[model samples]
Target: MADEVKLYGVAGSPFVCRVKIALNLKEIKHEFVVEDLSNKSAHLIKYNPVHKQIPVLVHNGNPVSESLVIVEYIDDAWKGVPVLPQDAHEKARARFWAKFVDDKCIPAVFMAIGSHGQEQAVAEAHDQLQFLENELKDKKFFGGDSINLVDISAVFLAFWLGAAEEALGIKIVTKDKFPNLTKWSDNCINCQAVKDSLPPRDDLVSFFKMRFGKA
Candidate 1:
């Protein structure tokens, strides 16, 4: 058990889910410690003093914070499975999209949820989705044909984004609207690693609907 990895995250968190997906993709076995963000813990405070967020990856004894940073660590530490491409340009491209999901898409999509008169917020959210659809139309996955770090960062956008779309009573990305991306996302969710990492379909839908006061 000394060689074990421990992931500090709640089950419902999309951010936490990203770390779970990365660990599985790299074939690293880990223990999961679900945390309550409402009531923070000392360990969480100590490891991620800055963010105090879930998804602090404790590999052996060292603690790595931030989902994307943990993912980079996982890829670098383990040699066999290539998470990020070896080539610098490809690596940059991967990082770029990951940041796009992190900085742009997620926040916009999440904010449009309950904002009643927030027209700008709503427009901004759909604009990002449209941009993603355009970028994704030519590629099988965000990072080429195989699932990579970009794809991992984007899985939430594909699935949770759909749920958010439903709960928010909005349709930023739809099958008829963005058919290619919708199809690609369906493919992403079906991958064994992704499928395993996700909690459950009903649970996800229920949680999101509950958040939007539908459940």
Candidate 2:
């Protein structure tokens, strides 16, 4: 018997996009059940009662929540097309970078574009981005040659960041600022799986414009 897999998430969510990209990379076949976060669905509530968030993966009745956790689960469950590195140290590095994306980078990026404290926030954001830029000095992807856990985890930087920049009329990621990261992001978003899984760029830009009152 085949395994039953279902992902509950809303469109245009980067966390949700992370799961979708991981599944696509692994070539996993699953049903994508969209959830309206404005009005929570019973299944979403049932699967992720603790957080009550989307991007919940249900495999054969077993539920997994959290975007990165779900990606790790997908990698572990599927042996083919490894989503993480095989080497112990490298795999650990991938996990570390993935965690950094959420713990450090996300907050910095948000603050940089936010209304209050633009000067300090932009500096902090660049500091964080420098770490990533240095990390990608000569690498094509965070996973080295191909996208992996780190790349999937940081998918927001590839697409959503651009939308935010366009809508807010600010440019954080620039060729002069982060050449390597800029190149790496280009490769990531252009990948067939990542491209297919991403939400429409224009829609996301509009969303940012509305939210930040930049429209």
Q: Which candidate's TM-score is highest?
A: 2
Clash pairs, model 2 backbone: none
Q: Across residues 77-195, which tens digit of lDDT does each residue of candidate 2 receive?
A: 98778898989999999999999999999889988777533777888988998998988889999988889998998888888888888888888889998999899989999998899
Candidate 1 lDDT over residue span 1-215, tens digit each: 33678899888777787888878887787899878888988999998899888789998789999889988898888766677988999899889988998889888877876563267877888788787788787787877777888889988877787776665566666688778788888889888778788876667777767777543
Q: Which pairs clash inside model 1?
A: none
Each prediction's whole-model lDDT (CA): 0.80, 0.89
Q: Estimate each model's TM-score.
A: 0.90, 0.96
C-alpha lDDT (0 to 100) for residue 79 of candidate 2: 73
